[model samples]
Target: MTIGVLVLIIISACSRVDGEMNRVERASGGSPIQVVTTIGMISDIVQEVGGTEVVVTGLMGPGVDPHLYKASQGDMKRLEDAEVIFYGGLHLEGKMTEILEKMENKKLTVAVSKDIDRAVLRSGKDAGGSQYDPHIWFDVKHWISATETIYDALVQYDPTNAEQYKKNAETYINKLTELDAEVKDRILEIPENDRILVTAHDAFGYFGEAYGMKVMGLQGISTASEYGSKDVSKLRDFLVENKIKAVFVESSIPTKSMEAVIAGAKEKGHSVNIGGELYSDSMGEPGSDADTYIEMVRHNVNTIVDALK
Candidate 1:
């Protein structure tokens, strides 16, 4: 092996016990399962369902865009040390797909959205043509399904803790179901004519579908997909024609593009206020109001409703 490869293996080995034993040690009630997750949205649900049984290390954190993210060697080490790995698939982590594929045989690598119904998935075109949008967590019902997928994966990998996973998943899913109803109701507070959600990118398609709003983005599904001045000018004209009152900025995307849209709207004798900063590709920072998945959804809904209504 090359010296660099050898060093990484040694560092990973030194960081954890052999065979990810703490997971194997579950029957003995040892350390929790070693889980490594890709995005923060997936990380939250896994933690909720796994509870005290799994210690999840999230690779992408607040404001980190998964579309443009490239895994570092340290991330590779963490993935190697993990007992089980969960990722948001459907090309969410497009750059990391090969690594995840290679690790599946050695570990129980799973896509949390694996069991979600294909019919409901949103498709968008990139330079590579069409693909399913990876922002499923924006749709509460879809995430409810993803929660069960997480439960199954946890049970599959660590059956010893099956009972715990089931209990936690049930509780969390119930709350999400309630959240589904709540948003549907809260969205009604915004007059249907005014419920348009425009953002820096098309990350909120599922959100618009679930909450009864028309969604638009300056960019396409993947932030890696470039948006030109023409795209912005077109969106600006649409906003002015539609009389859209607000546009949202994403935590993970630069605000300059959206700012350009706002400036463009002003020159056309129309005023479009920034609705609020919404947590799109990533959740809020730890301990913040929008940190968790549910709270993040709530924050987005409240921001949208307050700004548009």
Candidate 2:
């Protein structure tokens, strides 16, 4: 459905729920804080930091692309009901940014990545040169910063559980620290010459910068941008020159573009293979090795190391 129609429907549905929401909010002393997050990454962090004090509803699930996601009627209702909404800003939710911004006046809407230092963020020329990469969760340290943001937001909205939120943030930060160290160590297994990552999109710039890999993408930072014939040819030539054995695909993006790249490289006398599917904009299915953020990082690192080493 068109976003305009979706918004209208949501407004109507929300008006009906307004009275009931007020009643629930009045009795919220014993209930969890109602929260809505744009993507799984934000949802997971909020859940970890909020603990028993919050109930998070993630709008985008596993293998869903935030860049291309639009709010459904159900998603709009969820946002209307939420006491607070968290999203990975920097225009990650390109289609839903307007609605989220409009909701801010009515609710405690926050961009989890807002607290990140601009100096540390990777600025790109894509999207009219004003965009910073929104995939901050790829870098463990950056994500640790985001965890603090989520914790602070939770505390601000629900001060009664400030102590619990602080504790949860501390524990999760420690885990992220250890995960960062582990990723570095595992990435060391691949030789420097093979420390190049060619993926479906430029979603891994932060990851490449953190882990010391030269990253290239078939498309720009936002998957919404298209790649031309020249772009594909240039990437293929780079693959051939470097003798790179593997190129990776993303879970949320179609692999056809990467497959085309592989075929082009073969035609030019290079035999590059599909390394493995990487969770770029989204995590794996629940109960899988990459279900959580930590596990997702581990799975991606293991995949890259095994294929490149």
TM-score of each: 0.92, 0.92
Put down candidate 1 lDDT per residue, 196-300, tens digits, no spaces: 999999989998888878899999999888999899999999999999989999999989999999999999999999989999989999899999999999999
Model 2 per-residue lDDT at 221: 93
Candidate 2 runs further than 4 Å off = 1-28, 128-130
Go through the candidates in order and give each one's C-alpha lDDT.
0.86, 0.86
TM-score, prediction 2 = 0.92
Give the runs in model 1 whose Cα sits over 4 Å from its true position. Answer: 1-29, 127-130
Backbone clashes, candidate 1: 0
Ten-residue segment with the worst summed lDDT in candidate 1? Answer: 1-10
